[model samples]
Target: MNMGTRTDSRFMHLADIVKVNLELEQDWTGLAVHKSSPRGDGDCDGQKLLRPLLSGLPPKRLYIHPDDQIDMIKNLTGPGESETEWVLPLHQSENPTTISMLASLFDSLPNPPVPSRRKRIILASVHNDSTVVYYIVHDGLVKPRQN
Candidate 1:
């Protein structure tokens, strides 16, 4: 098989893993797998290296801004609602190079409908045995939430 074919197959497999992990395991709703334009030749600086990203709404709010949390606590209000979040699914083997690539692609993503101070995504790392781990990534430094 050619390189293109192999890449395509691998992408599809990763997409499936993301879908199952989000929908079935995590019980997230409105899951969508966004197709990237194309893969590039190890050029992390270029747009061609963009990878597929998944977006969806989780059952509960996965993140709350520090300021927002303070306000909610002061007013005795509950966590309002969950917002749509971006998810980037990558194989465990790809983690080393993914950090550099993430900056470029994160900037390329469309702004969220609800205006916010920062851009964030859920990084979903898929292991060889199908165990997917998730981490929250932000475009820039954000104040830590109060415990």
Candidate 2:
């Protein structure tokens, strides 16, 4: 397919993801779709294929670092308000996403509210039936939360 057709297909998939999220009860806010531009000559050519990413704030905190969880327990403080998070929408039928692509996406984002916090994004896998399965994806290794 031509570049325009490919671009249009990606946009439609992104729209579907947004629509499914809006229809859910999470009350997503400050929704924004980001476009990526190709970088100058370098080893970052893969970044050029990076798709648009969705970013917004959920109604409640979706994740807390293991260290933060301990701090919260010690301080007897409840989980804080949710922060804006990156969302990558991928159609199930699409080719498997590459680590380099994800790394590029992570690099594009601004630092987290807490400097100690790790970078993460919500990976939304859209299915043909309009089902969107979300998974938390961190940029690097992080201690898993205890039950």
Candidate 3:
């Protein structure tokens, strides 16, 4: 099998793991996550290949490289836009996503966040036992919730 196939399979597997967890543990009744096609150039997964969460939210780009060095720019949809363009990055569950990586992602965003709106990405890390944990990474510091 070629490298592209391997990456596709990995993404598909991750997506499946995520879906199962969402249904069984998270109580996501009608959740659906789609795996994107590979770019076919043997490049690491990024915005080019996305796995969107549900139907309303934008698809998240999958990144599995040990090093979080992304060169793609995130497309930020303007306010009032019906759909979110481009994609959000998702770190593989097993990978250690550092604060610097998160900062780079935020810096790569095409548009600045508007008041009352925050920019974030989903980091889906899968464990050795096939359990995946998803975290929402914000662009910058956010106010703690009172709950």
Candidate 4:
């Protein structure tokens, strides 16, 4: 970190989070909190792949249409056809200040927040900023979960 970084309001102050770059492709590498990644953890499982891939990109979009949802729900059950990873192309953006601010804000939370499909994807939130915050979203089910 540069000593003069304090002067820049848009710099990463608490950017302690480190990532592992798994992909050799120039467009995207991996990112994670751990120095070493777990085996068979899958591409979409950790920050190692998801973070840098989404850093400056738009809120993720679904490639399949609504009609396919019904088909998938009926036929693609019981894990015979699970996908390896759904690739979404991204454009780079920077938000050092926002990330730093978020780090401080979320530091107090005890539980590590898990990203479900609903909370993960944030479609239509893109603007002229360097990098915007993105969340996860899940596949829709006909009946809600009952415990």
Please identify which of the two predictions, 1 or 3, would achieve the higher TM-score against the true structure: 1
Q: What is the C-alpha lDDT of each candidate?
A: 0.77, 0.74, 0.46, 0.28
Q: Assess the local accuracy of residue 76 in candidate 2 as a C-alpha lDDT between 0 and 100.
A: 100
Candidate 1 per-residue lDDT, tens place, 13-120, comes to 897898888999889999887775222344432354356777799999889888888899999999988888888877998744456677777766665556775888
Q: Per-residue lDDT for 1-147 in model 3, tens only?
A: 598788666666666676676557655444555343222323333443333332223324222222212212233332233333223324454454567755654444444334545665556666767666666555666554332
Query: What stretches of model 2 exceed 4 Å from their correct place?
Result: 37-49
Stretches of model 4 off by over 4 angstroms after superposition: 1-4, 7-11, 14-30, 33-68, 78-147
TM-score per prediction, in order, is 0.81, 0.81, 0.47, 0.20
- Each candidate's clash count: 0, 0, 3, 19
Clashing pairs in 1: none
Candidate number achieving the greatest lDDT relative to the actual structure: 1
Candidate 2 structure quality by residue, lDDT tens digits, 3-99: 9788767766676566457546468877766665323445553354457777788888889888888899999999998888888888888875988
Ranking by lDDT: 1, 2, 3, 4
- Which residue pairs in candidate 2 collide? none
